[model samples]
Target: MDAETNQSRQSALGDLALVVGTLVAVKQSVLPFTIVYAGPVSTFSAMIVATFLLYRRGLNWAALGLRKPDSWWRTLGLCVVVFLAFVGAAAGFGAIADIFFEDVGASGRFDFVKGNLPGYLLIMALVWTHGSFFEELLFRAFVITKASTVLGGGRGATLAAVLLAAVFFGYRHYYYQGMHGALVTGGIGLVFGLIYIWFGKRNIWPLVLVHGLVNSISQTQRFLGA
Candidate 1:
């Protein structure tokens, strides 16, 4: 590789190391504050810190996969594909789980829906978008980028980074959603991770939309069932 390529690789690796250390430490340190503080504040703080580090290192939005789309039509097509892929995968996995485990039935989600469809919709939109976009931004974009850079860019490194983020992502949801949620979210994380890598980490608008759609569908079904 040329001197410039070598330099870029080194820089990416350094960024990756900084990112991993920050995430690990921030997650652990912030837990103690949950009694007095809660919700997305901790994540928001971590995001701000990560952004500061990137800016200090002279990293721009493009470098962080924040590129603009070429055309609206193209963007729409990409959105459809991502939506189908995400929903289809989620359904397939959920079905498989249902078949193997009788106890793992789809019950609780609909309870919320049946009781209050409108309320569920509103809550889901807020939670999913906030959960999906920010989580994606942090894990898929920021964390994956750092890991990929540090380990070098290739299939192995990419998959490794995805797995690493998925573990943490899965853990984050485990408390609220239980083991089932953990599995589903982890699976979602893996798919989203691949999509980000495949698209070279461009604007994540479509992913956010898909996430909202998926959550809406899931919530609506529950409400209707109830």
Candidate 2:
């Protein structure tokens, strides 16, 4: 292989390692350290490692699909579409899970926000940063891009990358959301992945907006006891 191909593979391998390391750390410490703390800690740590890796290649966050959109209005429209699709997907998947599982429990971690003004406010305050931006950056952009590259970079590889990333994204929530939640979230991830590519992989703003909307609605429902 040429030097360029070799370097690309090596970088992809580094990204894989980064992802695995972060997941391991989160999984190991989540129970004892708590996701509230462990989540951000692992996320930022992975961000740091990712940044360093990008620096080595003289790239930036933009390389991980954070480019400016061609049209703001188009992105906004896409966000609305994606948000509705997510709601439908979640409901459909939840129904499917119900057929097999007796109790598909919710994520208990956010239970403290239910009917609690301060907790709700705090979570809402960090919703964009913690729930939307970072999650998309890690699970969608970073994982899909690197995974596709690692899989040798083709149309089929990209689809497989999306599937793999979606599964991992779902697994990340299993610690708190149980199997049902994981499956639902995984379905959501698949939607996000497909849209991420369909809307143009270079721009992630639409996905971020959609994710923020989902989190905001969920948080509001919890706050209002819905």
lDDT of 2 by residue, 91-138 (tens): 988888677754546556788888899998888877887678878887
The candidate that wins on lDDT is 2
Error of 2 at 166 (Å): 0.6
Q: What's the CA RMSD for each of the models?
A: 4.6, 1.9
Candidate 1 collision pairs: 16-146, 110-222, 113-223, 114-223
lDDT over C-alpha atoms for residue 205 of model 2: 90
What ranges in model 2 sit over 4 Å off? 1-3
lDDT (C-alpha, whole model) for all candidates? 0.67, 0.80
Model 1 reaches what TM-score against the true structure? Answer: 0.72
Worst 10 residues of 2 by lDDT: 100-109
